[model samples]
Target: MDIFTGLINGFDIALSGTNILFCFLGAVIGTAIGVLPGLGPAATIALLLPITYIIGSPVTAVIMMAGIFYGAMYGGSTTSILLNLPGEAASVVTCIDGYQMAKKGRAGAALGIAAIGSFVAGTVAVLGLTFFAPPLAEFALDFGPPEYFALTTLGLLLAVALSGGSIVKGLIVLVSGLLFAMVGLDPISGKIRFTFGSIGLQGGFDFVTMAMGVFGLGEILYNLESAMKTEIVTTKLGKVFPTLKDWSDSKWPIIRGSVIGFFIGIIPGGGAVISSLASYAIERKYSRHPEEFGNGAIQGVAGPESANNAASSSSFIPLLTLGIPGNAAIAMIFAALMIQGITPGPFLVAEHPDVFWGVIASMYIGNVMLLILNLPMVGLWVQMLRVPYGILAPVIVLFTTVGVYSTQNQVFDVYSMLFFAALGYGMRKLDFDPAPLPLAFVLGPLLERSLRQSLLISGGDLTIFVTRPISGTLIAVLVLLIVGQTVFFLKGRARA
Candidate 1:
């Protein structure tokens, strides 16, 4: 289909009553959760995953779900600028200069830059997705079992590498995720592998329960260790829009961040968090007034905020094109798609253009909605900070428990949730990131399935992964990643 024709059809579908309404609701709910610190997009989406199941249309459900993620990117800057609190991990870099701007009584301008930058960057990313996704999907149509196994292997490794922490620690958790995914019956043999003589175990872990426990409940539990306090920005937000000077200073940063984020977002594991951090570093490097960074530089706020939002938008590209979700939130959306019996991959654009293009079209509308929602209504979101985490935490706990139990009336599912919630809490305290775990869990079975198919095709020959052209390239890339990591690690040890 012609790109223009596809987009027009997409806009037509996106403008329909139901899609528009759900899109708006998703934006509103997403921003609300984002303004309320400690309930980031991933956890919020996990908590709300069941609701999407209740909705009939997969496109509408995804439109809403997608809105929550990028909307959170915009909303996260609210607390970062006003309270010096990062509502999402991706917003952490914004705090360095955003809060400093608030102290300087430029809170409103700081926020204006973030919102405007986010909107521009988001639009750029969607444009990138519009042009890039269809062709990538076309290219991916040729993938066979060998290519798929190799790709999954690379994806799992990239997810671990960019997850930001000790590589060894990430590997350990990654392996654990794969093991946990092996709980049910063997996919090909039809024999149970790890079920401990229990029917529930035979069915394996519930995705919704495990996700709710680890991300939703676990995050709430971890936040209970400290008191929630809002540091009020005393200065009046005199001008909510950036001046011409602020605009001039931020235009280049916004452009650079958009490009940086759109591409980085395509790589597995390099989502909003990494994009924002990378943008900040690049902005600092390019700044003529380097000292101004971390000291109220508008570029600092503009660049990272743009990058994070852009990353959030473009992260959809992989899922929509290659069937690889780049982050936790997108992974949840992937699960949602699976539940709806819609598998996103090379065939998505060709087979389900409505789901593919309607979503792209909705983002254009969603970004406009968010800009309108965030820019003028800054004061409304500020009010969200008043509700303390002490109250919010328990509310989330209660909400997730009910949501999980409703999925399966079994008390064991709730118990399973509680168990993972505790596991999430301990992992948090121990500096082991729980984000990669859920994603790994989701990918594990697919990886195993692909590996099995590839081996079968090659008559159990192990070199098939390196023998096929596309698979060989992917394997070569993985080899480079491993060698690169080893060299980097050795250099770090030597420097120490």
Candidate 2:
């Protein structure tokens, strides 16, 4: 199919009353969650996944989820500038200069630049998705089972290597996630292995249940423990628009951030958080007046905000084209896609063009909605912050519980979510990143299937993984990452 035709048809689908309405709902909800500290896009999508079943259209469900992901990136800067608190982890870099700007009574300028930069970068990323995803999907159609095994193995290892934490801890989490995938029946034998004599365990863990428990309920519990009173900046915001000078200073940073973010977001595990951090480092290194960096530099605010938002947009490419999720949020959406009976991968464009193109197109509309929401209603979002976590926490928990129960109407599912909620909280307290676990869980079955298929083709030879061209290269890269992690681990221990 021609790219323009697919996009046009996508717009036709996206412009419908239902898709548009849900898209707006997702944008509003995503922005709301992003503005509220302790809740990020991944958890919000998990909390809302049950409703997608209710919506019943796979294309619409994915459109809404995509909106939420980028919308969270768009809204995250509000709290950073207004309260010196990061609304989500990706916004932490924004806090450095954003709060300083707010303290200096330039809150309006900082917020304005962030919104504009985000809009530009979001557009740039969507353009990248528009042209690149189709070709990538076409290229992936040639992959064999060995290649798939290598790809999934690489994905799992990348999750550990880029987890932005201790590699050892990431490996432990990765192994734990693989174990979670091992529960239920043995795939080839059709024999139950880990059920431990329970019927519910035979079906294994529902992805939605675990997602809500870990990302949604678990995050809330962890945040409530260390939650503190916060006050929005009291100084007046002079204007809601950036000045000529502000735009002049920010134009180049926004461009640089956009390019950097688009490429970084394509990596399996690197997403908005890492992209934003990388952009900040690059901006700092190249700035003419690096001394002004932590003291309210407009370039500091412009670059990271744009990078995070751009990363959010481009992160969809991997999931839409490669079957591998770009990050944890995309992994949750990948689970939602499966629940809707849609398999994302090379054939997705040919098999479900509506799901593929409608989703990509809806992001364009979502970006506009976010820009409109973030700009004119900046004040409204700040007011939302004043709604104490005391009130917010219970509401979230209630919604999360109800959402999980509604999915399968199974009591077991709710229990599973609560169990994961506890586990998720414990993981956070231990400084263990939960990102690798969900992603690992999502890819585990695929890796197993690929491994089994490759082995069958190679007559049970173990060398099959490294014998094929694509698989061989992927294995080489995987070995390099492992070796690099070893060096990193040793250096950390040496310093300790």
Candidate 3:
């Protein structure tokens, strides 16, 4: 299992006709949604997960899905530049200088630099994945159930802190999700907990249906309540290639952003949005001409775009190596692997080498496809905005409903999905973040299993969680996060 040999085998699978085709399809679909405002990659992936089972192989399904993740990162800049609209949270910073450049008739150049920077960052991230994932997984081989419980507990806490709302509210949502996960039969004991005498509840809630409901249908429903209007900035066609001056100005920012983003993405709750923001802030701090940032600085566009893409790629590390997804997109990926009957963890690289490596290799190919798609196809993506939301929302709902129903071929699953959709919409209207809920649901069973196993191994001693080195360190980190968040919450309330 040398890195080179692993990569070659990965490329062997990735370069296959079927994988390449799916990869290309994913890139195209990811870019399409990225250009269309309001439908982020997480929702798109959740919406698509049901169809993944039909793809026949886990490797191809995951490769296509991974392509969508990073491809959206590459394509999100298109709308940011042309319409001053961010397709996802990570692209928000791009709207600053990117829209300014568009106004100054440098839209094509801005888009070009973004594509180049994304490609470079994404390639670097893939290389990092190749080298870093195996060792991390190997290190994790020594972990026991106590360590797992600690890690998952820490992950849940991090999700609440980063979920972007009242910490109390996030906790409530997290708890609700955990309760929802309790609907099925107990993992350890065969007896059911909360089914309440429903036959469909016996099998528990379908994760795919719930995901589609909460993320896909719920998002669409929430967006429909808002009055969204787009005014596209149409300018004269210009050269799609960046000039030497543009390259000189952007080269260092791209590299710095990539490095910053990769490390940030490794942390729990760290993601493309935060990484891009950090990159923009750092680039501004170090820039010789700091005042040019909000105006039309290429660094503003280059840094954040590169950082977000890099973060998106490296964020896969936690999921692949540790079985913990850092954010909702990666959570969807985790769910996909679970649906494929493949658990991602320390042994993932050893047990499912094809999946682990094929995904990495597909990223390299996907980045190239994105670069090739971004330039000549920019106009095509721009036209996508012209589609009215009035017509679009129903289509999305119809697809989500069909996808959910297709999972069990039962009307009850569809009803369950709509129920969660309503719940998600209600939460959104109340300013409660639903992001943590699905993630919490996905991790709840594993967390419970780990806790039970740890307790049994320790013979009912609670001290085992804090007694082990790895588990102790994780618990310490979790305590610190809770204390910090409590202080922050109190301070905010005092100020308010």
Model 1, runs deviating above 4 Å: none
- Model 1, range 1-496, lDDT digits (tens) per residue? 8889999999999999999999999899888877878888888889988887689799999999999999999999988888888888899999999999989889999999999999999999999999999999999999998888888789878988899898998888789878888888888898997878988878888778888988998888888888767765455665889999999999999999999999999998999999999999999998899999989999999999999988999999989999988888998888888878899899999888999999999999999999999999989988878777777777788888888878877888899899889988888999998778877888888888998998888899999989889999999999999999999999999999
> Candidate 1's error at 175, in angstroms?
1.2
**Candidate 2 structure quality by residue, lDDT tens digits, 1-496:** 8999999999999999999998998899888888888889998898888988888999899888888898888789999988888998899999999989989899989988999899999999999999999999999998998998899889888877886888778889888888898899878889897888999889888888888999999998998888656675476676879999998999999999999989889888889988999999999999889999999999999999999988989988889898999688999889889999989999999999999999988988988999999998888888887788888889989888888888778888889999999999999999999988888888988888888888899999989888878889999999998888788878988999
Q: Write the per-residue lDDT of candidate 3 for residues 1-496, one digit (tens) a residue.
A: 8778988999999999999999999999888888888988989999999888899799999988888888899889988888888987789999999999988899989999998999999888888888999999999999999999999889888877875668889899889988898888998899988888998899899888888888898889899888776675576447778999999999999999899889888776788888899999999999999999999999999999999999999999999999998888888989889999999999999999999999999999998999999877888888888888898889888888888888878999999999989987888889897878877888899888999999899999999999899999999999999888889878988999
Clash tally, candidates in order: 0, 0, 0
Say which prediction, candidate 1 or candidate 2, comes out ahead on lDDT.
1
lDDT value, residue 102 of candidate 3: 87
Instruction: Please identify model 3 stretches exceeding 4 Å from their true place.
Output: 227-229, 494-496
Model 3 backbone overlap count:
0
Over all chains combined, what TM-score does candidate 1 have? 0.98
